[model samples]
Every structure is written in structure tokens, then in C-alpha cells.
Target: MTDAIKANIEKILQDSHVGPMATVQNDKPHSRYMTFFQENLKLYTATSKETHKTEEVEKNPFTHILLGYEGDGFGDEYVEYEGKVTISNSDELKKQLWIEDMKHYFDGPEDPNFIVLEIEPIQIRLMNKKGKAPKVLEL
Candidate 1:
């Protein structure tokens, strides 16, 4: 990866704690804000298995993630990721990604309704600042 892209990627991962995840439901787009963590260069978000998002992903694995943050005198930088979602039941993954603060949402990593949204980015488009064309990278 180019240094600029790599730097932007790290800035995104460090600056933002949540992103909007978009999924398709009933042939329409649905989006929701979610807190995410990163592992192995992939983004992870956990949701209830019974939620609409879980059902949507089961039918269509494609998802889009938008993460952004305002920078110090650098305007805003945003990253868009196109990825395939995988329904994960891996206990180890949950354990690894678990945060104490997140327990309020999940009861625990072992909660029956809990499921992981593993987004493996296939393509990334990053806009470093206002009025600049995005830099696109294939993952």
C-alpha cells in the first residue's frame, strides 16, 4: 500500500470508534450505526442474530462500511469499504474482540443472540480531505 493510503487507513482505524454499516434488505438499502473493532486488518461488529441485519446478510453477504472522522486542520477523511459479510459463531473471535464496555450491549460474549459481522474489505476508497479525489485500493 502507498504510504498515504496506509496512513489514512490507520488514522481511520484509530480515530473512529463507530461506522455506519449498510446492508440490503428487501431489495432496499438499510443502514445502522455500529461500534466496531479491528482484528487481522479486518473490521468486526457484533449484532443480535435475530436482528434485521443478520437476516439480510444471510440472504446477501455483500455490505458496505463507511468510516470517517474530522482531522486537526486536515478537514475530514473518510473511508468506504466494500466487503463480504460472514456470519460468525466463533467463540474465540468474540473473546478476542470483546470490550468491557460492550458487555452492556451483549450481556456477554456468550450471549445466545450474539453474532459477529466479519467484514473483509475487498476494495477501499479513501478521501483524505475536501475537494480531493479519493484514493482507491484493492485489498
Candidate 2:
């Protein structure tokens, strides 16, 4: 990614904590709010192993995520990610990324029902203001 694009991405990630993850299920679009953390140029989020989101992704790995920071006067600043989601139970990744609030979702790295949703972006589009469409930036 270019410095400009990378900066834009980091800005969006830092400004927004929640995003809607869009995935296709049975040929239809499904979306849900998800809290995410970005690391090593990949996106990570935790989910219960028994959720429908987990089952849906297992059938189809493709997904789109949009996160933003809204301003009262200025247009909403946001970034959209087009990526593939990989679900796994890697202890090292969990430990490395764990934050305090994650304890509510998982007992620990060893939580049986906890799993990480890793998103690898193929492309990213960012729009920081109005009168402009999202500009595609490489991942």
C-alpha cells in the first residue's frame, strides 16, 4: 500500500471501533456489527463458535467490512475492506492480540467457544469526506 493509503487506513481503524461485516449466505447478503482490531495488515475479531456468522463463513469465506468515524458537520470518514475471512483457534494469535474487554467473550486463550475471525484484505477503499467516492487502495 502507498503511504497515503496506509495512513488513511490507519486513520479509519483508529477512529472507528465497530463495523458491519457483510457476508453472503444462500445467495443473499447478510450483515452484522462487529468489533475489530487490525494487526500485521490483517483484521481480527472474536466471535462465539456457535454463532450463525461462524457457520456462514465456513460455507463462504468472502466478506466485506465497513468502519467509520462520523462527524457532525464534516461528512463521515470511513474505510471499506474487501477480504476473505478465515476462522481459527490459534493460541499465539489470540494471546498476541488479546485486550482487556475480550475476557467477556472468552474465558481465556483456551476458551472452548472462542475463535478468531481473521480477515485478509484484497482491496481497501477509503472516503474521508464528502463529494468523493471511495478510492480503491491496494492491501
Candidate 3:
């Protein structure tokens, strides 16, 4: 990828706070909005172990994520992520990614039901009207 594209990708990853996470359930696509956090290219999201989404992920590890689009206008930039997810129960990771707002769903970072969904992207496509072709990022 060119430096400009790389920079734009990083900016989107850093600036966007929410995204749609899609998972398959009963042969149908299920999607929902989620708050996202990233460590470099790796994506992380918090969830309760009791949720249906968590159960769906346990059955199928693959996921699709849509991020960066703010609905400002046509031609807005966005990223589509194809990845495999693994559930993390690590206390340290939970603590590291925890925020005050998370208390609403989780008792605290130590809440047993609290878990982190780690997404390792196999392919990421950076797309917008400016580019003639979508920038396929290296994993």
C-alpha cells in the first residue's frame, strides 16, 4: 500500500469509535452496532458472555466488521474487515481495555461475565470514492 493509503487507514482506525459487527446465526446474517477498540491493526470489543452474539461467535469464529463510515455523505470512506475472532477472558486484557462507561454492562473489569472479543483480520479493504480501486491492506 502507498504511504498515503496507510496513513488514511490508520486515521480511520483511530478516529472511528463505533462499527457494525456481523456474525452468522442459523444461516442468516446478524449484525449489530458495537463500540470498538484497537491495538495497532488488531480489533477488540467488549461483550457480556451471556449475550446471544457471544453464543453465535462460539459456534462460528468468523466475523465481518464495518467501520469508519460516519454517514456524512456519499463517497465517505470506510473499511470492511474479514477476520476470525477469539474470546479472551484474561484479567489483564479486560483491565487494560476497560473504561468507566463499561460499568453499565459489566460490574467491573473483574466481572466474570465480562469478556473481550479479539479480531484478527485476514483481509481489510479501505474504500472511498477517491480511489479508483479499494486499497487491499496487508495482514
Q: Which stretches of model 1 miss by more than 4 angstroms?
A: 71-74
The alpha-carbon lDDT assigned to residue 139 of candidate 1 equals 59
Candidate 3 overall lDDT versus native? 0.89
Mind sharing the TM-score for model 1? Answer: 0.88
lDDT of 2 by residue, 72-133 (tens): 55567788888999997998877876777878777887788888999998988887567576
Q: Per-residue lDDT for 53-135 in model 3, tens only?
A: 89999999999998899887768999888889999999999999999999899989999999999999888889884656789
lDDT of each: 0.82, 0.83, 0.89
Write the candidate numbers in order of decreasing lDDT. Answer: 3, 2, 1
**Counted clashes in each candidate structure:** 0, 0, 0
Sort by TM-score, top down from the best: 3, 1, 2
Model 2, 115: alpha-carbon shift in Å? 0.6
Residue 104, candidate 2: Cα error in Å is 3.0
Candidate number with greatest TM-score? 3
Q: After superposition, how far is residue 50 of candidate 1 from its true place, in Å?
A: 1.1
Model 1: pairs clashing at backbone N, Cα or C within 3 Å: none
| Index of the highest-lDDT prediction | 3
- List clashing residue pairs in candidate 2: none
